[model samples]
Target: MEKITLYYFLVNNKATLGLGENIKLLLEDAALEHEYVRLELDEAWNNKKVQLVKEGLYSGTLPYIEVGGKKFGRTVPIMRYISVKLGNKYHGANDEENQILDSAADIIGDWFESAKLAFNGSNEDKKKYVEVDTPRFLDIFERYLSAQEGPYILGEKISYSDFLIYHRLDDDMALDRLADYPNLTKFVQSFVERPNIKKHLASLSK
Candidate 1:
């Protein structure tokens, strides 16, 4: 029952969730209690709040967290830490299962680099990424899902990787691009419908 604090950037009255958002969604899904400290990126470098975040959390990054007096940075580690604290879900059931889930999660992290290229790179770079790199990554994920007995990733149980994958794909790529990947599309639809996730997402829009 220790307090959990998340320090992240806010833009236009909305928090930038990108990687940090999924952690918020996961905490909500698990019915965990936490607080958020939103910072503005433009002024964060010299701002007192952000400076405290860097010093207190030992991280020069947005999406820093403090829980039980210990600080953490990065998305996956934070998710894993909280999931472990909550117990018996989100993370895999056993060591081998956990490893598989971790691998999947790491793959999603790798995809984010490609997503950046597609989103922020020049026109030709974006086109090449979307037409070439994006589909290849999607195919890998689609194949993984198809191989599973899934309404969630790694089989029927929803793991942290599922949320990570969903956010990255939906937030970064055009949904129409998913037409050829029915299983991936279905996974997104089903994930968003989960009661807590649905509620959390609605709150983000506000």
Candidate 2:
């Protein structure tokens, strides 16, 4: 088996933070020996990113990740595939667990997309989006957490789901909604402080 490689293309910013950080952290937590190659976006990548998006090499989205020369367009899918391949067991041990994890990841992805609109759109539009859409998303995640006992979404074991939730909250915090979910806030605090995560964030900041 050839050593799998990951090429991560991203802008150094918050919009891509959730997926970007989740994938980066997941790789570290899993302790997979893979190279991290970034194609820092500039005017140059605009054409290429667009081309890749059309080719299904990327979603033309930030935090573009390719593994083994094949691109996985979205963050959660990328994380899920890597977790399964590395046998990290963050997704779940059984089929039921995997389903639950997948559902949780989907919820996070939805919230992230909605919140992106809130962050980037006009003030009036942001207000309307948050008022009309944000709470419902938050409510669903709160309910999901209510069913789990954790420092993690999968209950007591930190899986890719926790990483997704953690980074989403952090990325979404700027939009003023993340503080509403106490369980998520506490859960994120617990894992984000882990040495590897702290190190990763620190390195990125520098």
Candidate 3:
């Protein structure tokens, strides 16, 4: 946990915003020592300083982490590294748990891509996503959540994947559409009520 610095962009895209905010929220909730350095368009994509020292980093990419004087890339991997730095509270307790963690993370990634198709794809693609694809994913999410014994997938102990799940649901404005999604509704309500997250949610409104 030596001098952790997260470099993220100032973008309007909710997905990007959610990833960066999720990192900050986790760190904030843990009271971890961290700093968020906002990277402008030039610094993120074409900075000479970043280029000169980018060789040893995982992807030499922005939306990355600089910790212990080293860089790590890719969203899920960086979150995993953060968990390790924080004594692995968000990590799985064993191999079986790790399998669940990885599987859940993969599902989150896949769901994002499917949602992206609705956002940026052709009209026909969007139509099918709304009428067919979205309902399908929502059903998948509902079943998985209902099968869990606690609010989170891994029982009461919240994992890193839960943050992404919360964001995807919130970003899609699914927070208000909860007539048939009781488990998901509980997830959203409980997530927003977490102390640090509740404060952040309030700030977003004002």
Candidate 4:
């Protein structure tokens, strides 16, 4: 088998909350052997992107991860791959549980899409997103989280999806409605306070 490879871009505003960054956070927490590579997002990277395509590495999208002859690109699939790769404990117990988590990931993807509008859209659109879309998604996550057994999404178990959820909620200025949802707020705090992840997250800032 060939060596595994993964590549993804950092989020512009909150670098730490990026999909690829979360993967790095997990790898660090697990004490895994990995190297992070980043190129200046300028003409040099533009030329390099073409080279990656020619070399069968670029998928034209990010969170592009491949391991053990398999590749995944997209939110949920990438999380699932990383979850299983990290350890079975970071994944769902059965098919049904996995499916439920996938559903939650779908919601997260949609929620993030709306967030992008706030980041790049006009003033009116941003206002609409803040007043309408924020509560719509937060309410759902709040209810789902409240119904769970404990701090983590899988209740007592830590999953890769939890990291993704943390970033979306942690995105400053965009997802402010999180405070209104007690469960969601508590979940984010728990993730921040986790010993290994907390240390890992602090490292990213420096």
Pick by lDDT: which candidate is best?
Answer: 1
Candidate 4: regions farther than 4 A off: 1-6, 10-14, 65-75, 172-177
Q: What stretches of model 2 exceed 4 Å from their correct place?
A: 1-18, 40-43, 50-62, 67-70, 129-132, 174-180
Superior by TM-score: candidate 2 or candidate 3: 3
Query: Candidate 3 on 48-107: residue-level lDDT in tens?
Result: 446735567645655677777677777788888889877888887888887887887898
For every model shown, what is its TM-score relative to the native structure?
0.87, 0.76, 0.85, 0.82
Off by over 4 Å in 3: 13-18, 42-44, 48-53
At residue 35, give the lDDT of candidate 3.
85
Estimate, for each residue in 1-206, the C-alpha lDDT of model 4 and write its tens digit.
13445576655544554557656666655666655654345677777667656767546556666666555566556656656655665678988777767777778878888888677989998888878887787788788788786877788777777776776676634445566788887787787788888887787689
Off by over 4 Å in 1: 11-17, 46-56
Candidate 1 residues 121-147, lDDT tens each?
789988898788878888988987887
TM-score of 3: 0.85
TM-score of 1: 0.87
Can you list the residue pairs that collide in candidate 2?
A: none
lDDT, residue 51, model 2: 85
lDDT by residue for model 2 over 99-178, one digit each (tens)? 88888888877787788777788999788775777677667767777677776767677788878776665665523465
> lDDT value for candidate 4?
0.69
lDDT of 1: 0.77
